[model samples]
Target: MKKHFLPLILSFLLFACGNPKETNNEKLTIVTTTSMIADVAKNIGKDSVSVTALMGPGVDPHLYKATQGDLSRLQGADIILYNGLHLEGKMGEVFEKLARIKTVVPVSKGVDPTFLLSDPVFTGSIDPHIWFDVSIWSATIKEVLAIMIETDPDNEAFYEKNAIAYAQELTDLHEWVTNEIASIPYNQRILITAHDAFSYFGRAYGIEVRGLQGISTLSEFGLKDRVDLVNFIVEKQIKAVFVETSVSEKNIKAIIEGCQQKGHNVVIGGRLYSDAMGAEGTAEGTYIGMVKANVNIIVNALK
Candidate 1:
């Protein structure tokens, strides 16, 4: 048992090393856990700061374990940002250690609890995937703005301007999502994915969401869970079920097979960016782009 926990313990111990190495450059060295946060930093910081994401596209934050290289990047980072509420469960120790000496922050820190969805499996833990709902993500933008300005006070004016512009973009995105969802016929608005990451998305958009596993992918999917989900999807005659970019498609395949066993046909709607975003350089790689792509896929499949 000790051997099994040794890796995470070793990683956390690395934070006790001296202060993060100075880049000796003008840019504010920012390291983020997810691509969404990295994109926001880039958008707000622009050319003023250098932003890096430890988990790239198709990477699931729930199960992400730090490598030696990742620990090096975190230690050398001037500022580190992550989604709180234990989203990065494996890195909790390291984040706590870094908080003692560095300005490590969680993007969800500024979000109002009234707007947050509590994780059913984890007591007192809120779902950290706020980017799905553009309205909720605006709160995260504010958090990013505050930190960026705090880290680089000299460029306060520029950061504020960029932040305001980005806020408006989120407003537009929120409206766009609402409009897109409204266009889909009433009962067909259900969003079924491999995991329960989209509860926030469903709550914000007024769609019903269900998943085989719990909110976190770390939870197991059993034979009973499979049968129940198949029954739900079949009972609703849900036209399509979706898979996630970060999670394995095996659960989805099993669900389809179960449905087939009962003689109901279900096709995979399309892959949605859940825990992670699309590959960088593509439209879905960016936060806004990821949301739009997901909405398009959902609407196309069920409509």
Candidate 2:
């Protein structure tokens, strides 16, 4: 009995000592609601934290239903970040609950209220998809920096430095988008897509945007939408319409066909990464790359 007890005590001591240094080095575990927010967090957090995106490429945040794994990640996170304003639809409740337990931040909260879009569908509520405009996103990034600093005050200097660098990049990107979009003729710069996800983009770049559906993917396109867009395309003599990566192109295809039936020649501008970034490892996979790819596609197609 004494020999057996001695072995048990030694085993307990080994277990207590095992990997103590490795456990202490574990980085802050951060969970984000969407890939876009996850991308921005990574840029600012750099190597200071471990970030995970609940949604992947082409996943629609509006219709996303959180899985058990997502809840577990959120529950374990040191900080949870999401684009608020009901972008996650029903899943926003989950984040609300998590906020009670941990540091949950709506990165878009700091965006100027005036810059937000108000639509009848939402009873004049602001649009949740504010990341489409780089300038607006710059404000969101600041909110993110504040959350990061709050979570790890010891790393305040690092987060501040990274946020400044990232903000500069965003400023450059905004200027580049403005210059590139300016190259397109105003009359020829109409942006038609499967949905009205680009309202902020159009507003920012001075382009007219029409959509087959409303802001939310849950909404369906009606005959009125089709007729109005077809007429607009014919009236404007627009050359092409765009489809989104996450949304079905069926509606846009119908629009293209309707325009052709009316003898109005139009083609698909190319697929735009609206709700998601490009496939991993591609140039358009990152947030900055995604915005640049979109600008390049729009400028090339419209110009």
Candidate 3:
């Protein structure tokens, strides 16, 4: 009887120590759909929350499928965040279902619906790439702060203070980006990439932007796209075309070959972080870092 009692006590202790339920004071466990959202949530949450981004650097969110581990993480998290506006494509359905059970918030849901681009494929649908503009992202950050406060009322003040500080940083970033881009002559500031992810960026920064692929990666690049872009580059004497970190460079390479065939010289400006950020520990790993890297690349390439 004594031996049996001792074993029961050991089991209880192990369960208590190893499987302790997360407390309010303990870090809030947050699962996000993309690295960019994870970065912004980190800034607002600071040390108060532990963030796990399902999509890492160079991952296309539209094509990303949730793994079993990701589902498990989402199931257990105190809060789940996604870009929404269908950025996750098929994954958006999963988040919608999870919303019924837990606090699943779309960080970009607060953006003015008018700011979203209308796409032909989805007819009446808006583009999900709102983070391309810093002003639009300021609104998204506010929503993140509100969600954090709602999840952990005890940390409301802390989250608010951090958010204000971070928002100021974003404000400064926007001004800096505006000034930097203004230095480049308008004609030299065209941005051509693998997809139409930068319409917001171009709209805000005063640049002409084009992409080989449509807003969704589900669409394939066709001959018309190739011919149009190649001819545009040749006719305009466009200096550089950029490639996205997550997308294949094959299409951009073909564009280069086409330009060369026309006796026009074009250079690959640099890789840009579109749907995702750089790897952890790199300058472009965080949201701010990703924007800064893009601004630097665009300024240097165009100037």
Clashes of 3: 0
lDDT tens digits by residue: candidate 2, 1-303: 211322332232211111112335667788988888888788777887899988888888889999999888889899888888888887977877777778998888877787789864768667777888787877767778778867776666666666666776877787788889989987888898888889889888788888888888887767887999999999989998999999988888999899999999999999999988887678787889999999999989999
lDDT of 3 by residue, 79-195 (tens): 999998888887977887998999999988767676667775668778788888887777777678778878887766667666666777777787788888999997898999998
Locate the minimum summed-lDDT window of 10 residues in model 3: 12-21
Q: What is the C-alpha lDDT of each candidate?
A: 0.83, 0.81, 0.82
What are the C-alpha RMSDs, in order, of all predicted structures?
10.0, 13.6, 13.0
Residue ranges of candidate 1 with Cα displaced over 4 Å = 1-25
TM-score, cand. 1 = 0.90
TM-scores for candidates 1 onward, in order: 0.90, 0.90, 0.90
Off by over 4 Å in 2: 1-24
Residue 120's lDDT within candidate 2 is 45
